[model samples]
Target: MIIAAYNAQDTLVRAVNSALGQQVPVEVLIIDDASSDDTPRVAEGLTRLHDNVRLIVSAENGGPSVARNRGLAEAQGEWIAILDADDAFLPGRLQRMTGVARRHEADLVADNLLFFDWQAQAVAGRALRLADDHVQQVGAADFVGQCMTGRSPFDYGQLKPIFRRRFLHARGLRYPPHLRHGEDFAFVLDWLLAGARFMLMGEGLYLFTQRIGSISSDSSGQSRTILNLQAMRDHTLGLLARPRIRADRALAGLLSKRADAIRDQAIWNRAYPHLRARRPGALLMEMLRDRRSWPMLARHLVRRHRARMLAR
Candidate 1:
């Protein structure tokens, strides 16, 4: 199990404990990304408390991608699993996922997720609603289609997957360090492009915590979020240019749609602050730079109007 932690002092223990409690034996690797908080100390404590737990402190602060890549390099496990510092694994998650992978002869396997609202201290909803016996084989087009932004608030990118270490090593596949956001989606996309056999299980075995201030739950208007979206868009455009991607018409079309959605989302993020401050000049400038912003702003206005009507 690989956990990339930064400023996760309070929740690190819970995540590590869940990994240790897994039905299948796991070697827990906690990579502390030069956190300013007491996360290193907490990780150290876990290393000393559990024989299977180990800690690695980065020399400099890198995002989750860098930290996870470091863990991947040092991991000795045959099957690799990722556990978010703030989230956890349900009992038997790794055991069950690995069983499915072996049965399907898959290079990568992902199960459904149960969203746990931290403030409410309860399970909110599930990531997928498929029947327990349902298992889907995900292809490149299918994966890209599900990840289109604005089409869904949550996407398949949120699914935590377990990968065969040999497949990753053989393909030299690692998370892109430049992307602090959507790195998981990029990584899985690369795996699929490299001919990975990806399988999805319907059972919700992973606990995804929805808490305020978490990286995944941050507001889209933030400057960092905008930059991340821009990076994802550029990355997707590059993928679309690839000969393999270009040859597959359906996959190319889906990727093009995903890139366009990402571009529009970035434009919306750029214009949202000005719209909120009622700065018509700045908003007009943004719309002029990207005409897509007009329709996006109009959609926001329509939603706000509906919300006001309901309140009245």
Candidate 2:
């Protein structure tokens, strides 16, 4: 698979290292979005040391989606692995993930991730509930259900998931470049709509490195972010109009997934205020107004109940 980045000088080395260190011998293709840093230089130097790691420098910066598209074109592996430039992979990530792909004959394998809080600690996470992988006679609803939940114990942002290259090409699938926010989410939705069987791994093999000043979180470019969310929602809603959605097992999952995507937008644009630093009172009020916030609020209640259960 391909590891794509733009101006990711500080974390690029570790990202490349993780790809190279995969249990399966992988072609760790690195695409630099014409970074104005030492990323290209560093990649250049490493090419001599590692034959698996290949570096390509783009003439212009087309963003990660574009960079990823470029890498997808050049990847030779039947399965493609994606790692953001900033995220690092734990050892055995590729081995376990690829093994799943081979066993289930899955088109897409979305695995779990261990998130590092701002302090870089292993905090509480959620269950993935990913359905079993079935390739030949895959159920659309079951497949889409796993993908829409958005949290399959996996961090979708990480480049640790494996994609069947032949499946991807057959469907002519590619990420939406214009979306600065949930572009990956949108792409996955389209793939699921087209009957991509998703397999989830419970293990969190990827490390998500949250960086400050990222385009998605930059208050300075809030318009672009908002537009991206709107575009994703609109795109997903359009999928519902397609002839599919007839799968009995996945109807609920599809609706839930749509709601979850909206809720995600809410978390970034609305629910963010609930934090103490962002003015909890106003945030709580907004959450009260929006029904989408209830699931998150219910999660809090469930956690509190479990805590009480343990204490008693």
Candidate 3:
């Protein structure tokens, strides 16, 4: 398991412990993102005790995506699992995940995750429980489409997913180190789009802490989230524009749905108690306003019209 941290002094140990306490033997690589805090000293101490635990201290501060990319580059495990600094894993997280990976021969395996409050209280339990029939062996193209279209639940909690290092390397996959918010979405969505064998383990093995000062908890600038969403939108559209990737109907459908998902999210971030306050229609129109987006929006409208005709 690879754990990435950015000045996560208070929570780093707990995150590392999660991987060490696992029932099976595992190595925990901790990447401290040039933290100004005592994270370096803290990590060094932890390494002395647990041989499976190692530390990668960055010379300069980089974002979480870069930190994870660094760890991904150095990871020796065939199966790579990511544990964030503020998040902890269940006791048997790795054992269960590796077991599923082997059994299914999947390139990627993700389980459900739960969130905890700052005081270590459970805020939400058993989140992302895939339906009983949610297990799927979709083609590579199909998987990407589902991710882009919001047909599947892929969120920050996906940090817990175990990835096949060989497969990821083969596809030249790495997180985009620039963006903060949409980095994971960009990375995971692209992998799915590239047609990886993605499997959901249907177990909850991650504990996401929602502390007040945490990045996830911070809804800082209204524009910050917008930039993140825009990055995701642009990345998806670029992929959709590819002739080969779009030739697959599943991938095309996914691109269209993901665009709507992005536009829908823009409307939702605003608090609106009335229909007039919501801009879903306007957002859809704005998405279509872009000449690049018109084709995707048109295809969606066409599909809806066909479905309506069939109903009539």
Q: In model 1, which regions exceed 4 Å deviation? A: 211-227, 270-312
Task: State the lDDT of candidate 1 residue by residue for 1-312, as single tens digits.
Answer: 899988888788989989988988899999988888899998998888889999999999888889999999999999999998988898899999998988999999999987665655555566676877789899888898899775544578878999999999999999998888888999999999999999999998888876332222333221111138878888888888899988999999998898888888887888988876789999899889988888777766664454334323
Ranking by lDDT: 1, 3, 2
In model 1, which residue pairs have backbone atoms overlapping below 3 Å?
none
TM-score of each: 0.84, 0.72, 0.73
Task: Judging by TM-score, tell me the better candidate of 2 and 3.
Answer: 3
How do all the candidates rank in terms of TM-score, highest first?
A: 1, 3, 2
Model 3, residue pairs in steric clash: 140-195, 144-192, 144-193
Model 1 misses residue 217 by how many Å? 10
Per-residue lDDT of candidate 3, residues 64-152 (tens digit):
78888989999987888888787888898778777777888888877776655554244444445465334455455544444543224
> In terms of lDDT, which candidate is stronger, 1 or 3?
1
After TM-score superposition, what is the CA distance of residue 103 in candidate 3 from its true location, in Å? 1.5
Instruction: Write one digit per residue (lDDT tens) for candidate 2, span 55-161.
Output: 88899977767888889889998788888776678898888777877788778876665443323333223233333332232344544444443333232433245
